[model samples]
Target: MPKGQEGRGIIDACLQALGEVGAVGGWDSSSPDGVRLDGARLGVSVTGPVDPATGRLFTPPNTDSNLAGLDLGADLARSTGLDVRVDRDTNVAALGEHAFGAARGVANFVYMTVSTGVGGAVMLDGRLLRGVDGVAGEIGHISVDRVGPSCGCGRRGCLEAIASGPAIARRAGDLAEEGGPLHEILASGRALTGKDVDECAAAGDIAARLVLESAARAVASACVDMANAFNPELIVIGGGVAIAHPQWISRACECVAREALVPANRAGIVVPAQLGDDVSLVGAAFL
Candidate 1:
């Protein structure tokens, strides 16, 4: 159900289970690990470590890191007796969005998810950018602050480290434990979750506001950087935290428009994601 590298196995299991349920109608789903049907084969495109001129992924073995998903999908598909399709999650999300979500009529747009980690998808001229290796929108790994916190990817100050839901919650939890205003506010036995922090911030709590503001600023900075790099006409921000704070979204837009290169290109940009929790499922289904 959740999108992750492990989703390939889950999907395989689900497909096997579905075989016991008789004919499953056309279903819509999404997952970061890609998708498969009962009868189709899987394929993946990737940019290997090898030079394009050599047509080899690497020097010796000719392996490509980006095509790992494709290889895995194919193997799993054969074992599970079902067809598999592997592609980058962001590209799949973009296709799902363009086909049935907020960017339906748009020709160019970006879809971003700010959850446990940041992820993105881009659509240009109504077509998703699969990239040479199909791993196009790996925005979460983008280094935002060279001196900031380290990411799971062993990098420092990534957009994900600063703006993801888990990052915000962890920071809020740390702040709450500092025995300051946050502790005083949460003394009523209401746990100070990220959602609680957002609520308190919205209610004018200074300490909570500070935590949220810090997170928002980080997200805003990253958004600005992304806008400057891509100059997309629209960016749809999804994920639990973004959905919780409309003000944060607005502030991020303001920050990006003010600081991004070619600010004029930032105009008419809207922040909205049509699918809520179902985005991944829908995207996977499309895959």
Candidate 2:
């Protein structure tokens, strides 16, 4: 396990989970020091300010925040007893794909995930891009609308707040309650999940479709901005919501081509991603 922000709780949970799973010679960095294995000494490295109120290091929960992953990694290495390897989660995803998946031979590409949140990573000449402090490719926090909903990172109108799976479900649930049959169906379920919303949309439920369209539009708008900025040859989009609705991939590409700079629009581009739920796990294992 690699610890960044949310380290303490994640570390505790991972320790319990690992024990339950019979993991041996485990590695974890759920602390500010460095990495820790079972019964090991601590290493020290510089990270960032530990939040006085929370007693936890203040790392960026999303791109909108000023903190960076390098700081987190250094802190973990210093405080724990394991060798810590760190990079943005999205960057790791891109590396995983380029090393073994759809982008194996590609030299320029971007990887994006659109589930509870939206995230992105970039590859150039088959190498992952890690910005200063290893915080490159954080697309979720990109400000799309100046006055849109407030993001988790205390920002307004980020791509994440508008297009992530949870965002879609929230919007859909709100719309469904306005006398739609889909709303009634979702209401009867144990919980209103993003999967349910996508299924309903696929089944021609008006409310569900509306919600999906809203999210898709926001995602498309963000993709357009990214396309213009990076102009990569391919954009691989993964995550639960996107995998459930492949049409969203096409729609996003269309929106980008229609809205991005002329040169970027002219570049041959496509949207796709291979690994699904296992992406994060695989990347974690690599770390």
Candidate 3:
């Protein structure tokens, strides 16, 4: 989350940006959407599970704000004076990739993000798969360990707990007492981040390598599962952690090739996402 911004505050800032750009003359905040803006509509992709039908948000375990039950679409429409549509960030990113990036022309694929937390969006036969409750692509919550570190979702041993960005930092912190380069960094009172761990691994720090390798394996395990179940033509991996460390994508590709079932292994190819940070932003336009 941005510094000191949440809920309506973030929305207000965005509305302000639109005004500055002359996208909208000005927002009253009282009168809402349903008004057209040169026949344009706004598509917003946000973190966490979204109600597929109603565009309401559920409390995302990773988010500091409890956005549960919030009707973001209605609010944005009301304020922005344009038709508004909302979807989970990963879902839109998958759409973005399919429409313009790595998965272009690919009919079946999964877009996975290994950033703040592991997330996924599935495209089956060229359509987004939204399960009954609109929370189908929650690959991060899948239990890899019956008993392991707790996850933000209040589960034990989720893939997020093992391989997400914060998980990398936490794992490094746990091993910091072993007196290695990681320990020295922690000793300096610098909070460890996934980028820090990746850099350390690049520097040949044993503890950092161990932590990163562990995460890689966990991610690989999930990729194998996705391959077996979805049999996607490609699994597009993105997000800060994977983009910063290509090793994660390589590890997933290697694992899938080795362990996925028969033709499934041959059919699915894991690749890095091409759109970079603008992926979801581009995807939102398609919403």
Candidate 4:
């Protein structure tokens, strides 16, 4: 959600993309701040693990603590001067898949995003499951290891703690000083990104290879657990990490097929999300 040369937020990007596509008017959505824009017919802002009932992000994880009590949804509706619908990003992405992407004909599926953070949305029997607090499908917080690194959600060994982009990048940067190949890779003095790990692994950097492989295995294990629990027909993967490394889906599929229960194993489908980056926006529109 960083701004561009002209201080463009996701809304600005959406506006430009809409213009290029000759959209008469369109809705904008993201998990960040409100912004100025022109030509948008409606605006949708999906912010936080917030309460839809109160539009408040009370003690939200992975967001500014100051946003804890803000009425993000109502605020956006005011600034945009058009109706603004708010929901969790994961749910929106799941809706996008159901309405316009890979799960077109399917009735049950899980939409997971593996980028800065890991999250998921679940649809069962043709309905999105919004739990009591609209916080269903919070797969990122599912603890995978009891003693692994701590997560932003204040938990240890959560899937996102060990397998997310930042998590992978943080581990790579920490091990960069271990000597040999990684030393040179960290010469830039900043940090190694998840993509950097992939590139270095491709060039035979042992540390990078290990980090990527470990992340892949973590992803596979987590997906296997989900397959067993949800018994969904499909798990559509998206987000920066999945797009950057298409192999994740295949690796996860291999693991799920081998590890999940007989019926669940046969039913699960792991595939890349079809709407790509647009799933969030498309899903918000449905909201």
Candidate 5:
């Protein structure tokens, strides 16, 4: 899978999988339209927002323009000759959780992922909230600090800029420069990760604790806001950073309880995702 050929790569993989399953016949790889996977449906979970009406992706923050305005569902449908459905990765993940994970049987809930980047999906009254443009639930861009660091979305102090995995590493790196346990790890010439920060904090490293605490506060603030806005029954936290650190989830739950509106706090409870990495995979099937 080479750069600039991701679309082709996905189609090839789909075709190969269909062929292996006896759902498609022999086809020329070069001619994607040579054959069809009749009656088969494909679901694509993408990294950015997608217009449900047109099935085209919006210009994602800090991403290649090629993805912007691209009708991925149409392209994949044409290439693989299968019914293709597409939506933001987080949105599908919410569906997955609602159908089989922590949010199961919950009618109103929020799903947030704190992995490579922070993202969220809102399910209200048992339905996904696709805004007028079909790109709602972009809580990552919510500004926690108006004067804080710049985000890839060209905003100042976005939650993603402060609490994403990369953000956690960046925060740790800043402390590392001042000579701390994080610095000792950096001295080993190994790049830092969110997991590293979690481990360091678990070991009682002051710098790591400070960094993680700051990130947790930011996340909690966002959760409080979401609780007030949606009054969800649960706020399901997922992704690498959250799963790696149960303390982070606990901290957010505490914050939400302490800071959110009385009714919202009483109604909303933050919890961990149960499906692990298979959340999106299972969700896509539901789509």
Candidate 6:
């Protein structure tokens, strides 16, 4: 929760949840051979603006900064008395999908997350592609238009700047000022979200549908670029907005097929993740 308390609460919550259904035990980290791991090993998947080499986060965006620069992996291992492996949340999620979800048995694929922010993970030739500093999948930062909106990363035209959940909300707010259907979606003190847009669109709200379509097209453009450039066997889409609007997934796949190099041979497929929420959890397990 604070400096040196990285991931402690989550670990505790997980153990508590495990306790609800079965036996639980705490062993000493110092003496690994003293006892069994209760038949299951544990790992943690953490997100951030982080330094993967050190497991230290760069002042986490919009969240508590106290835990920044802490080694959550070492801390969890010390605190939980279990073998712990840590990596970017997206990386582990990719692992989860590859091992048990949508990308199961696929040798090469890319996983993209579109939510409050956009993030991605690359799995090629059966390995995760972590860049020099383990900061590889900055797909959201890929510039789509040189003059587009400014991203928090201090760059303009980043895919995330134009297509993330907050981006949709911001667009909705702007439209609300124009005295349209978006006004009914957001009232005083009520924050419009990508999910709100999705729900509203599903009910035949024209303005809401437009907002989603725009976001979907931006996402599709990015995915198409990845398909042509990265050339993975598949590109798996997940996260809040993509989940809320299933059609966006199909739209993205269709776009890639039409624009990219032989998708049937190179890009393989573009689809929704099968793991759902368990994507990250199963990924942590694999780690």
Candidate 1 per-residue lDDT, tens place, 1-287, comes to 22232434544654544454333555332323233354654333222222222212231111223333234454556554455555554555566677788777878777877765677777777776656754566677688789977776778888777777777666666666545555665677665567767775676666677667777777777778777777777777887777777777788778776777776444646476778776655666655
Question: Model 6 off-target regions past 4 Å?
Answer: 1-41, 49-53, 61-64, 202-207, 262-268
Q: Highest lDDT: which candidate?
A: 3
> How high is the lDDT of residue 188 in model 4?
54
Which of the two, 5 or 6, has more lDDT? Answer: 5
Against the unseen true structure, what C-alpha lDDT does each candidate score? 0.62, 0.64, 0.82, 0.72, 0.81, 0.73
Candidate 5 per-residue lDDT over residues 1-287, each given as its tens digit:
11244555655655566556553345333444544665677777888778866568788785565667776778777766677888888999999999999999999999999888899999999999988889899989999989977899998989999888898888788876455668888989999988888888887778788877777888888998998899888999999887877877888888888877854336339999999888878898877
lDDT of 5 at 12: 65
List candidate 5 segments past 4 Å from native.
Answer: 1-7, 17-35, 62-65, 262-268
Q: TM-scores of all models?
A: 0.72, 0.72, 0.90, 0.82, 0.87, 0.82
TM-score of 5: 0.87
TM-score of 4: 0.82
Instruction: Evaluate candidate 5 by giving its C-alpha RMSD to the native, one decimal.
Output: 3.2
For model 4, how does the per-residue alpha-carbon lDDT over 79-104 read when each residue is reduced to its tens digit? 54445556678888888899999888
Leading candidate by TM-score: 3
List, residue by residue over 1-287, the lDDT tens digit for candidate 6. 12234455655554444444334344422333233343355656776555655555566543466656666655555544556566777888899999999999998889998877788899889988887777788788898867877777778878887788898887767765444456765664678877777676777677777766777888889998998778888899888767877887888888898888768443337889888877888887777
Pitting candidate 1 against candidate 2, the one with the higher lDDT is 2
| Better structure of 5 and 6 per TM-score | 5
Error of 3 at 172 (Å): 0.5
- In candidate 5, position 66 carries an lDDT of 68
lDDT of 2 by residue, 1-287 (tens): 33343445444444455444434444554544333464432222112223211223345554323442234444443444445555455666676677667677789888888876788888887676766545567788898878977887788888888788777777677777555656776657755778778787787778788777777777778777777778777788887777777777888887777777854445446567776655555555554
| C-alpha positional error of residue 268 in candidate 4 after TM-score superposition, expressed in Å | 6.6
Specify the poorest-scoring 10-residue window by lDDT in model 1: 53-62
Per-model tally of clashing residue pairs: 11, 15, 3, 0, 0, 0
